[model samples]
Target: MLAQTIVNGLLLGGVYGIATIGFSVVWGVMGIINLAHGAYIMVGAYIAFALNQWFGLDPFLAMPFAMVALFVIGYALQAFLLNPVMHTSLLLTLVVTFGIDLFLIDLFVLFFSSDVRAVHTAYSGSSLEIGPVLISWVRLVAAILSVLVAIASYLFLNRTRTGQAILATALDREAARLMGIYPDRAYGLTAGLAAAVAGAAGCLASTIFPISPTLGISFLGAVFVVTVLGGIGSVAGVIIAGFAYALVQAFAATYLGANYQQIVAFSMFLLILIVRPQGLFGKPFYGES
Candidate 1:
């Protein structure tokens, strides 16, 4: 039972890790809380759902389309909307994002009609058994792909010039400007990339969970908790913290009852705040600190 629980937690954590990476990156790079992140995720899921339903494309194959679409949306948001308020107080920015979130949710309801949709592939219901453990194929694929995405993101942030520039801006905007990095463009690009990652996560999630407008905010608490717990500025942090959070939830559900799962989870968040506020892997900038 314990081993099965652990496997379940790890699998869930892999998906959760991918889902929260963008939120971590955006907050770390731009200092924007991005209440609209959940909206971005929902859009991605819908994109995959549409593709699967209309043309019978696999959600994983449709990932790039969702990423590209979201990249454009995210970049435009920073260029036209967020950049204007770059110097505004954090509270104002928070309100602005909150409003954007509401607008996106409204659009989903208006168009998608709050219908719960899900993507089902031929293999979605299949599972693999290894000795006494059984693993759902969809979840296994999603988890593997999620880890691969995280690794790709890490390499992009570390190996590419554009990524380095984003990191430079994140490290110190003034210093980045001195080095000819345009903070505005960097900010926009960061948002675009973050949204792209979020989109990919949504694609992965569509395969595993039911989709609906109401599910837009489903990841809100989990992402925040994972981001803060894993430390604000790290990719590896999200991956690690994702598994940890999933394990915590699984154990709580198993031992304390499913009802207490979130209560315990949030309690851990509070405890983390009071005890080690910086998080186990917290740093000033991802990879820099």
Candidate 2:
């Protein structure tokens, strides 16, 4: 049972890690905490469901369409609204993002209702047994996709010129500008990439879990907690933290009451904050001492 729980957590964590990577990329590159990030995920899920229902496309194949569509939406939002607020105070940005979240939630609820929906494909119920581990094929697929996306993102950030520009912007906005990187365009691109990642995760998550407009709130917390525990600027740290959080939650649910699972899981977040305030991998914020 313990081993099974661990596997469940690992699978869940893999999906959460994808969401965290998106969150971290935006934060690390664009300095935006983007409270509306989960809404984008929700939108992507809906898009996949819609395509599968209407056009008979497989959720996996429909994911790229959802990703591209969300990317455009994210790009436009950043280009217009967020770009104008680039020089504004952080508090103001936070307020704006929260407002965006509220709007999206209401919009989705109005359009789709609050009913839970899932993309129930034929393979959704199948599982593979590898020795002691009983792995759901859907979970395995999601994990594989998550790792692929994360590794692709890592390579893009490390190898590509535009990717390096985004990294430089994250490192130092003023320095990036001095080095000929256009800050506004870079931020828009960062936002788009974040949305794309979110979309892909959403596609996978919808297959594993039911979706509702309010689902984003729960996912928002999970992804942010994972991101905070992992560290803001470290991709590898996010991956490790994802698995750690998953294991922690799975253990709590298995040994303790399910009701206390959240309490135990977030306690780790608090513990990490107290012990390593700079995050597990990233350096401390400027002017800490």
Best prediction by TM-score: 1
Q: Return the lDDT, model 2, position 65.
A: 92
Which pairs clash in model 1? none
lDDT of each: 0.88, 0.83
Worst 10 residues of 1 by lDDT: 280-289
Kindly list the per-residue Cα lDDT of model 2 for residues 16-83, writing each as its tens digit.
Answer: 88878878777766667899998988988888888888887888787799889989988998898888
RMSD of every prediction: 1.8, 1.9
lDDT of 1 at 114: 84
